[model samples]
Target chain A: MEEISKSPVSDVPTLADVAARAGVSTATVSRCLNTPDRVTEKTLKTVMDAVNHLGYAPNYSARALAAGRTNMIGAIIPTMENAIFARGIQAFQEELQKNGCTLLVASSSYRQDLEEEQIRTLTARGADALLLIGYQRDPQIYEFLKKRKIPAVLTWASEPSQNFLSVGFDNRKAMKELATDVIGKGHRTIGCISADTATNDRARERVEGIWAAMRDAGLEPDTLQVVETAYSIENGEAAFQQLMSGANPPTAVMCGNDVLAVGALRAAADLGLKVPDDVAITGFDNIELAFVAPVPLTTVHVPHRRMGQLAARALIEALHGRSPESVELPTEVRHRNTL
Target chain B: MEEISKSPVSDVPTLADVAARAGVSTATVSRCLNTPDRVTEKTLKTVMDAVNHLGYAPNYSARALAAGRTNMIGAIIPTMENAIFARGIQAFQEELQKNGCTLLVASSSYRQDLEEEQIRTLTARGADALLLIGYQRDPQIYEFLKKRKIPAVLTWASEPSQNFLSVGFDNRKAMKELATDVIGKGHRTIGCISADTATNDRARERVEGIWAAMRDAGLEPDTLQVVETAYSIENGEAAFQQLMSGANPPTAVMCGNDVLAVGALRAAADLGLKVPDDVAITGFDNIELAFVAPVPLTTVHVPHRRMGQLAARALIEALHGRSPESVELPTEVRHRNTL
Candidate 1:
């Protein structure tokens, strides 16, 4: 190990030192470090070589203990890397901001264990209230939040039989309506591209809705085929290919969300299948992608932004001792060109 | 306001109370609040009515001081409502997670003041390191980070002249090459849809690259038609319309990123303009949207996941008393059908 012969504060090789060694400006040194793409390859190498030669590293251990109580809220979502939850969470954050509250977000990547860990993590880190998605987590988790006296608001679904306060909509009914619409269009053999229905109640309810629609249409729900995968354009494409390549391909494909539908559309195009004419497609959550999709998707439009704003308002009101009524917003079916 | 006359914990009507009154399970009460979409309209109304009638409010004032030093990293992104930064940030969080560090994220909504405030807030909240975007923020900010011994990594751009450690590609070069290729296709008139170049160095450099390509081709850069706006599909569409409807519309359009380019493509289609035949278009950041756009887009591909992973490694290494060299990744231009 290198010897610590000099004072900790003064001896560390600064970016300026690297720049001086490389014959560049402090700004250039930073650009080389922070925005090397703006610099020439030659300049980039020169600065990087200088940095390596000088041993320049910025000290980043800035964590400190808070002095006292602060106005902060915490939220845990399935994932932060997609548009499905983006608008809603953004609206949630904005509403919190209006009430002078800061939102701390953690993504679970759709893993239940991870979600529980993050919930505890945020709580340990002193989050005042927690905003969570969906309602299918273990009952023990709810008991834990209650035990900790951490009021939580659930999003993306509403269960009138649950103990938790939720500001959400009916996923099962929304999907049922969409499925009914597809059935009305004379679709018989319906195929579904759904996310994991086992752990995710939302996905499960969506499938249930489709089954309900099928039963209503006097069709045997058991005859319907489904391919369960993660929510992604690539997965959706693969699922579509799997369904269409089968011996008895579906006349219409119903996706759990718009992301999957977009993928299904891409798959259809690659297979040279015209949407609505060759095989119709439907998606849930009329995200911006739905309208701009290869074929504008016929899907359910969830009020993401409104749901977020309402969730925030509900939590804020609760914090102020007002029991905001459990609000259940509505979803609409947007009939686009796809079906 | 009602007088506080009862014990804090015992008086609060839990979801169980609402459920009991509504003749449902505590789970149903939670579902009504969190996932109304999962419950029936009738059950949702009944639970909500009970909640309002019982004046049941969950207590959320759980803010407390952190026990001590902990492993945590903080990131402040421009916005959370889009896919542009999602992949990169997720990758960053994953890397941090592998090293036993949790990531806390804040969205700044692309406002400088908000970002500055969040930077301070995260710092005050005791983040071990910071992952930030771009290279154009105030120099004083870097000084503040250094003064506090806060290790920071700048993403999205690699500034060869800055003091901050960055893991990014050359935005200017990536876009310039795309523009050069567009120009080589025998199109003299060009149009650019860019974000605010003044504050966003990445956007500014992207425009500069196009201008540089124009100059190299012996074209007057001043003659290039330009439209500046926020980054969104709607704005991109409107900007495209403005560009095409002008007295001298460009034969080719270059967008700052894939999102804007998709919008432009939509506009082109709506106006009955066939892509490439009537007007060629290009974009930066070959996001998933680029490939799925009405026209598969020709754009520059930035290694988003890799950038995020490398940024995380840099900060973690710095945290561990290791001086890691700044990293600058490469970008490629994909010439799809749009160009």
Candidate 2:
């Protein structure tokens, strides 16, 4: 390839240029670019040849403004640093493409203000609808979306809020089941490592669910040691060390997610402690890392791909003036060697 | 939060409306939104207050068209399904934000056609500049960008082509160093697993580098067994198994990336093979997972954060009419337990 000049060329091709080259109307060129399947095979080949020869690029902004909608759906995830949300988001994007909608995704890094700003940015960029992770943002954001007539569907945690569309599993219920399984293994003393729940409803709900299970089993929920940290393997390791340093260490440790659980497993190995003999550990999210861990982790299996697919379909339906109903998916706790 | 109606409010706020309420000109409102540091503190507060009171969102399309620049940089990565590009893209986004620019990221899933489409979509959406992964793409796309005068910077793999700006490391040199280290460990028979090299320059270069190192060490490079797969842990594990099942298996296994290396380690364990004793393993890209693996991996440590930060700054400079020179960062060979 040769270096092209930075200066703008005078004869930049337009839809009209393509139309003249293909011997068709400008509308036909626009149709070929936007909805190629709608054009006849012979006309499609001619217009595409013209498009290639003239190197014409469609003006998305002009087309969006003229059409009064961009057919674009935006999603705001907490972060993409791990596999926790990757599978789900991939499914969501594929579903959106199937529905003729493009996905524009942004990461908030678990910051409420940043999320709000991204919501505005996506809306300003002409997103017809949105897919938010949780229903914990400020009321003002909802108002802004409402005023702009942008439909949004929340995911990851099921909140029975009629005011918002949601598609997710019950986080609290899933955690309770995992806790019950850990307790059923004859472990009375237990420690918990949870993600910082300040702005995360899912993490908070998971912790509460674990507490409920402990209390129901006649264990002192108040006495259960809890360490809150960022969702990382290193943090999980640090939290595990802190818990084990106490005079009366627990026999079992539960983590907020798979990333943290994998960390605990690493720490256990570093300490020369055998899993399921010296201590048992559990995790949530059942990400691929759980299976790849030195000791395969016992975790709650949330339907990530299903959540993403449902959220995309629901948002698209809502955009078409059909109110999308809330969906609650089921989760299962897998009892593995970790327990 | 209450459900807001789907209908658009007739009294939607505009920049002019904010200006009227703040007792300022529309230009002041625009400046307050785009470049808050340029506005006086008092004026900024007033303008922001007015914007909040009216629930105003600046129309990005209109603003881009009016200013002939969006102050937005778009990045088209291979995939976001794993941690391969997460750390670098995070650094890129942070650097872009610091430079008063926002980022719009899209993933191509390693498909050349999808990548080309994303480039055109981003350009048509008014991205002032672009960050492409490699130099390989349709020539017509380059022609289109040149005609539009869009500044683009390639990343992830350094190329000698002066046709474009790039910020990355020498993939071949990095891999050669790792392979040489493996050979020095008294390993003659070595098998390699790599990502499909058809559309990826980095993967192709890494494979070539390994062959170069093997041939230089008097090892028959043609005898080296190679398995090409996707850059995933599961694929790595399968590849490892296939290599091990063959007659006269290699004493050492090399992987294209850390994900594959981790998989190979897992497969070795499942097959009751010992690391460094029964067989040795090597990986590239010292991701966190490499350290957390049961046996730590010896790999090449690329400066992901530095590459991202440099790419952003250089692109911004190029957009400002300065020709940014291509940068080739250094990679280090980390000799850990696996080797």
True contacts kept of each: 0.18, 0.24
Write model 1 residue lDDT over B1-339, tens digit each, in one string.
111111154544677878889999988887787578899999999997776566544322221112223456788888877676888887887787777566777788888888877787676555667898887887667766776567889899988695668889888888888888999999999999999998888989999999999999999999889899999999999999999999999999999988899999999998999999999999888888888888889999998999989998898888776777888899999989987
**DockQ by candidate, in order:** 0.11, 0.31
lDDT of 1 by residue, A195-276 (tens): 9999888999999999999999999999788999999999999999999999999999999999999999999999999998
**Chain B TM-score against the true chain B, candidate 1:** 0.80
lDDT of 2 at B66: 50
Residue A163 lDDT in candidate 1: 73
Alpha-carbon local distance difference test for all models: 0.81, 0.83
Place model 1 in a CAPRI quality band. incorrect
lDDT of 1: 0.81
Per-residue lDDT over A1-339 for candidate 2, one digit per residue giving the tens place of the 0 to 100 score: 011123343576888999999999999998888678899999999999888777677766666655556666788888767676767877887677666566676778888998988888778767778989878878988888876778888899887565788998889899999999888899988999997788889998998888899889998888778899999999999999998889889899999999999999988988999998999999999887787677889999999989999999898778667877899999999877799
Q: Give me the runs in candidate 1 sitting further than 4 Å from their true place.
A: A1-69, B1-68
Model 2, runs deviating above 4 Å: A1-11, A37-40, B1-11, B16-28, B34-47
